[model samples]
Target: MRALSYFFVIFAIFLAPLGVAVARHLADDTQATDWRTARRDSTGIAPLPAQTPEAVIHVYAARAFRWRGAFGVHTWIAAKPQGADAYTRFEVVGWGVSQGRNAVRVGEGVPDGYWYGNAPTLIRALRGGDEVDALIERLRAAATAYPHQHEYRVWPGPNSNTFIAYLGRAVPELHLDLPPTAIGKDYLPDTGVFARAPSGGGFQVSLAGLLGVTLAAEEGLEINLLGLSLGLDLSPPALKLPGVGRIGMSEE
Candidate 1:
């Protein structure tokens, strides 16, 4: 019992930095007002020209609104067809289903708009080409087929990240490497202990997102505990922590 106690103490010490990081992130983004009044406009990350006559696909993630930002991020997909003027954005929104609408929302809003005041980070990008256009079709199909269009959960979920993760599996061409902070990305739909990893680069074994293991080139080897991911980045040689995301800088 003393040995076990020491083990737990060591584990808690290891986890302290990550926990502090998460708390700091939440404290920094906390706003006094409610979410409805929070800013949601483009944060200047989108292209200068909102309307583009080019084929492009971009997957973006931003901190979730309000308190949720501490634990994870919200993700969405945007695609523009050849010669299209505006981008088509696809994402799962709980509010939609709460009002008796589909959780998946398609709109002509800014492709890289800030998600309820949190700035976004581009996760994947593919631009102008017939190949990208083909991927666009697959993206649309994946969006239409999302099983959780009527469901949403803030944690361990079929939330927004789950929607994007579904597409990541369905459309392997996108090669979506969802970040470690995307809490709902591991919530597999069916009742199975095994499934393709979200990156579509390798394999994963998850017990309804509560616990899991994943191995892939994009994500390396990850152990998911209650939706928090801890892993290593094989290529970049970094540590993936729950609150801090990736540590170990890379040469850009």
Candidate 2:
């Protein structure tokens, strides 16, 4: 018991600083990301990107559970270019079986599940009138400067590197979490792009079990039935983008 307590203390001390640094870094990078005024193209469809050559999408989801098989809300995200055929997908699936119910699994078949950058954050910033190219550049610069921080890694790694992170140097808005923790491992994609799950249980039992216990401790584990899937199509940029706009936000 004493040893475990010591381990946690040390873990928090070391992890807290690292988490804060990552969070701050992400915040700075996100602030520098460009936000574009997405418009309906000639086809009346607003594709993912309007000016960039390659576009990306982002998806994320998480759930918690309790002993009797209670679960938390499932979440997801989709980020795609202004005009494209298929969007990347991310999902969260439960893995354990209870009362004949299946286990919990997450981050599959949702858009941009492979992308590290936050699509909603980027899009919101763009809608708020940030420059897209500059955002990309800042993200790229951050990517280059940091090269280690990722959405899902115990330490610095590209395990979570996704196509979204490769967006021609455009940075995405950092979803706010002051002290960022390592993104859980499974959601971490293997490469620049994400592929659909071939088969098998989605969430590994260890992580799922940990998450279930943690959430159950907090919220008493409520059973939730949340099913979400997003489909996106990007055609092509109808409007030309202006020279990189100046992001006026003050940096910390």
Task: Please report the candidate that would top lDDT against the real structure.
Answer: 1
TM-score of each: 0.90, 0.24
lDDT of 1 by residue, 80-174 (tens): 88877778898998985776888888877788887877778887877877888898898888888888878988888988988999999999877
Output the lDDT of residue 231, model 2. Answer: 13
Q: Please tell me which predicted candidate would have the highest TM-score against the true structure.
A: 1
Q: For residue 116, what is the lDDT in candidate 2?
A: 27
lDDT of each: 0.81, 0.26
Indicate the residue-level lDDT of 64 in model 1: 81
For candidate 2, the per-residue lDDT at 233 reads 12
Put down candidate 2 lDDT per residue, 135-187, tens digits, no spaces.
43454344444322323221222222222222211232432110012122213
RMSD to native, candidate 1: 2.4
